[model samples]
Target: SVNSIRRTSPTGGTSGLCFKKLNITTSSYRIIINRLDRKVTVNYRPARLPFSRHSLYVEDTGSMYLIHTPGGVSMQWYHSTGIMVLQYITRYNASVPTRGLCGCCDGNPEDDLKLPNGTVVREVGDMMLFLQAWRVHTTDETEHTRRVGDNCTTGDCSTCLSMLRQRAFTPCHSKVPPEQFCDIMWAGDLHYKDHQCDFLAAYVAVCYTHQVCISWRRHNFCPLRCPPGKEYQPCVSTCTSRTCLNREYYEETTCSFIREECVCRSGTILHRADSPYCVTEDRCVCTDNEGNPRAPGEVWNGSARSCCLYKCMENGSVVAVEPDCNSVPTPLCEREGEYVLDVLEEGACCPKKICECNMTICDSEAPPCDNGNRLVIGYSALSCCPEYRCECDPMACPPVSAPDCREDQFLVEVRGQKSCCYSYL
Candidate 1:
């Protein structure tokens, strides 16, 4: 829904990534985001393709789908479209009523702009009023130049047209409109020219979705050069019909599913998924997990951490990474504590968090009560330091009244006041 989630760094830097999160009218699927580990999951499963280097090429479900468990709801995130097209594959409970920016989803177009107060803005002129009703109050920390949209600009915008003139994408003019896509490139040139390639790539991806294939790439511009003996294609079947590892037999999952990738054209077989190296049965190449090709019969050290030997073979069972150096179980003490994490080879899955109990916190050191205010042991989940602190009856100052706040909000306490424990919005 165009969140504009621009995260200006805590140090006040402008460098940050921004993306829009589209909300769908689905009831069953729940996305869990773990802020601590920066992990995103849907229905307790990974939301991305396994071992994908960029994490952009998700699983090929003939059509990429985010299948949620239990309620049977599923969706897919298109990496190229720059949008989350949530296709509700399952139906919600008939008795249950659903509502949001997408509206009730009960087949009514008039109630799409329904406010939080359950009042729908019927007049189109008052749409701004409806927007103001739902507008977030947070201050914008990102600069206007860093916004993720095209600020329609006027200049020599021949750069986007140049990519169009190339023979690779020359046939896609009538298939997909380039005016809106070119706006991003032209606007970006005036501010930051970095997004030119990105916008073009997204445009190509969107065109591909519409079954309009356009193989656009340049060595000097948005370069995604194919490795030796392999070439990038505008659109190709997602299934690997054959590979260097399997010269004989392989299952063709689907021929309709299409995507953009570097492929072995006509005669040669693919060495690996989009790797620069291509191969035949007589001259084979083994690609490590990181896409580096290893020569045939060459015993080279793979992407192993903490010392381990591995050789590239026909089977693509390879993994190597040293991510999360700080993830090891760390011990805290005046002197160095004992280490218990079992050292293993790289790219291990389902990693367990090695924890060591080193210390405990008990004393909170609560403030002393005033005169005539008897201290009594009390328990309140909302109160801070309640484990050690005691409550005061007949407050030192004056007894305070709890603030009237919304149910979704909690009372905020302030110190040193005549009306003790007074709260504010």
Candidate 2:
């Protein structure tokens, strides 16, 4: 049973907009409308009764109409319990029928033009007639909000009347309204903890004066770039050279500038083996092992000693010598040294061409030899060469040729003499 059905407003307004709701004893549903904000909030409750838990049925209907002087506008909408919804907009002017039964306004009347005498006149009473009708009915049940009222400001009925006048004259108005697109989409779905519900329907009307405007737009154009060694000069339709240095030249092909091929002033087309740069007159001429200028048909030795000098191998063939001399069987290990040349016979490999000390020879004096069992001890020098040596320590002492002394007398030995006994007291 729909027990408590009333309307209230948490935020009071002069426009007399009251939120309507159906309040049952155990559950209540309410709809809140903020006219100034053009927003609608709906609160709903599920059936609590055991048998009718899922059988709750609800519906809502809203209508608004205004007709006073110059024009009038009306909006209406109907919604069923989670089912179908219908909405439409109606407008009329002074020339139309008093009740606007056709739901359309008459032709746009002429605007008042002020003349020099301060009197207003109309060029034509009626020129163009226009009737705009918009209606939408959907059964898709995709929980959506439909705009039921045109935008209106908070004032008096006169404000709505002024909007009605603008809407009526919309077809004949000279100034274009600012271009507006649905940039913002508000979700009308009602949500509860785990329950999903739809906003069945809503209606609203707005009246206010506003200027017409169009949208802003422009085309996108990107600029191009020039190739390497080139500078782009706009409006000339061509890439220019950046004045290349040395043997570099600029080549412009297909609107882009690139470095020209390496070409030497000298007519020789052959290039050095190590580099791609063409051989120029200023460079040294290639030569053979005898230091003579190389002639045509001679194989160029890539492993030459100098940039253009070749060497003759032991086999009587001329070729570029290997850069690392240590690879040769008879490498030059040292220039001048007594120890270096003397020790080199140990191995055929080249001795290091650096100063070195003989580490096998020890420079310390020998220790005393043991009776018949001399042992070599390991002792090393403090020098950088750190020569290790062998030394022996005597473990035996000389035998004494004397008799033992008495208990009360101590035996004293004289320097460079034999031991003798003496009385102390």
Candidate 3:
């Protein structure tokens, strides 16, 4: 849905969008459209700016490509027509089938209206009731909602019938009915020619994939204006770069989809997908790792494990050197007498954020030994400081001897002291 689907702002128009699948809101994203300049902004997930097809690991936010497995799903959004295309790039598997707004994608349309609890709506009259289940309840404030018997008529689009039924579209008439497409374009936005053209272009693109080319645009109606040196084509590759970041060359035969786009003319090329202007091969620009176009004298070192910081040179090449630990800044820690060093990864030359103890910090001073007892110093896991204990030492005892032993009789000790012996019996 294009408006707020969150509970806090049902009609507040705050959140960008919410996609619900089987009674579950997949993700919440906000889209801000600038009325003054007709620009669009997406906040928070995937990307804020325009981007080409990329792996969607987060599965959160607006029209985007998503793939859990290899070639699972591909989504494309044409902002001009407000059309979003979700396709299954992966081969259909009997073990894993999708069931939702797209229907049970198992080659059957009968079970397409199955509810979240696995109940199918079998009655034709209940189709409206089934559709109401997926209603998000967002309406354009600029227009009035038409009731069943209201005299709400969209302008006269009777003139579009002949064009839709033209001989050029005969091959695609059965697959895509002309009356349906014509009426939808009129009902959607009758006054806006671009909207009508955008609406028609969708059907034309579908026909092109079926090996039919549509020449529906008129010279004065929705005529496409391309950049200088570029021409509009009925069919082009879907693997084209949308942003100025990626600069890889692709084989035209390996395109995933054949659609319409503006292509550069001969002798001119785009440095990256998002380049606004066409230039000669030598005049192409360069981009950094973050998808930002960079000029000469800029530096980039966005790679995590790389130990070198690169500088963009005038020749369009980034120069780098394998810097040692001296190039990287050392971290400052609290207190004195502590040191810091890098605990690098197995094959990485860069430093990690781990800290190790270089010196032991003891707490209290040890007391003097007394009574032939010695103080023992030991370490324990509970603390980094040394622990003190008192224990008896045999060598630390006072010297003991008898004064004299009389004849055969041994000397008898007075009291507990051995040195107190005076006379023996």
Predicted model with the maximum TM-score:
3
lDDT of 2 at 45: 31
Residue lDDT tens for model 3, 73-180: 455443222234566754644445766566777778888998777889897656555656755564431221222211114445565666567676788887777777
> Model 1, residue 67: what's the lDDT?
28
Worst 10 residues of 1 by lDDT: 49-58
Ranking by lDDT: 3, 1, 2
TM-scores vs. true structure, each candidate: 0.39, 0.18, 0.46
Per-residue error for 321 in candidate 2, Å, reads: 3.4
Best by lDDT: 3
Question: Residue 237 in model 3: shift from native, Å?
Answer: 3.9
How many pairs of residues collide in model 2?
Answer: 10
TM-score-best of 1 and 3: 3
RMSD of each: 23.7, 32.0, 18.7
* Candidate 2 per-residue C-alpha lDDT over 284-314 given as tens digits, one digit per residue, 9 for 90 to 100: 2344443333433344444333233244433
As for lDDT, the candidate ahead, 1 or 3, is 3
Give stretches of model 3 more than 4 Å off.
1-72, 76-83, 123-125, 135-160, 167-195, 225-231, 241-249, 274-277, 288-312, 317-425
User: Predictions ranked by TM-score, top down?
Assistant: 3, 1, 2
Candidate 2 has an lDDT of 0.26
Off by over 4 Å in 2: 1-319, 322-338, 341-352, 355-368, 372-405, 408-425
Go through the candidates in order and give each one's C-alpha lDDT.
0.48, 0.26, 0.50
